[model samples]
Target: MGSKNISITEDAYERLKAHKREGESFTDVIVRLTEDERDIMSGFGAWSGTDKGDHARKAREQLNAEFEDGR
Candidate 1:
């Protein structure tokens, strides 16, 4: 594949370099950082079939009770 030259500030270069893993190219780091294109509904139902939902509900209930009690 052909590559093009682009200019970036020293600070920008340093930041990108910081994110680069050992034995990885700058192109690989750029792709890895920018390739995440998630849908809005991707996280829907993530807590389903888990006790996390119940825990959140109980926490909300406790907060509401405390608010009603003016504490």
Candidate 2:
């Protein structure tokens, strides 16, 4: 594949470098970091009908209560 040159700040380059494995190129690190990222919309309805869903619901209620209480 053809490659393109890009620039990043030193901090960003260091962060990416920290994630690079011994045998991985910068391209490999970038692809691996991003490849499994999920769209936020894909999570809609994902928790329904599951025990975790109930937990999440309870957590949301608690958070809402705390917010209402101005805590």
Candidate 3:
């Protein structure tokens, strides 16, 4: 595998460092954070099979209404 050198601001470096688990590489930390986020929206549906769909749908509707009202 090939890796490229990239530069980040000190603040950004520290943020990633803070998220790194013990014995975890910076690359692993970054990939874990980003990959989970990419599928987070789809994750809520997994709860829908357990009778949580109505609650989840109501929450979504309330959130949408609040945003529409400029809250």
Candidate 4:
């Protein structure tokens, strides 16, 4: 595998080191930190269903009414 060298300030280095576990390399910590497993498609079509669409519309209407009343 290929590697790159970058510089970090002492404070940044200390923060990364603080997250390091026993017998774990800084490379492992970096890899673990940079990996993202959040569902990218989670909200892509979340309101595609009829029920969700209706619920969202109602919520928006309620919010708008409340704001108009406050004003």
Q: Rank all candidate structures by their TM-score, best first, as comma-separated numbers.
A: 2, 4, 1, 3
Which residue pairs collide, candidate 2? none
In model 4, which regions exceed 4 Å deviation? 37-54
The better candidate by lDDT, 2 or 4, is 2
Best by lDDT: 2
TM-scores for every predicted model: 0.55, 0.62, 0.53, 0.60
- For each candidate, the alpha-carbon lDDT, in order, equals 0.88, 0.90, 0.85, 0.85
Q: Which candidate is the best by TM-score?
A: 2
- Per-residue lDDT tens digits for candidate 3, residues 41-62, read 5666565453657777888999
For residues 1-71, what per-residue lDDT tens digits would candidate 4 score against the true structure? 99889899999999999999999999999988888778885775465564546777888999999999995
Report the C-alpha lDDT of model 2 over 1-71, residue by residue, as the tens digit.
89999999999999999999999999999999999988876675576565446877888999999999999
Q: Tell me which residue pairs clash in candidate 3.
A: none
Regions of model 3 farther than 4 Å from truth:
39-71
Error of 2 at 25 (Å): 0.2
- Model 1 spans > 4 angstroms off: 39-71
The weakest ten consecutive residues by lDDT in model 1 span 43-52
Model 4 CA RMSD to the hidden true structure, in angstroms? 3.5
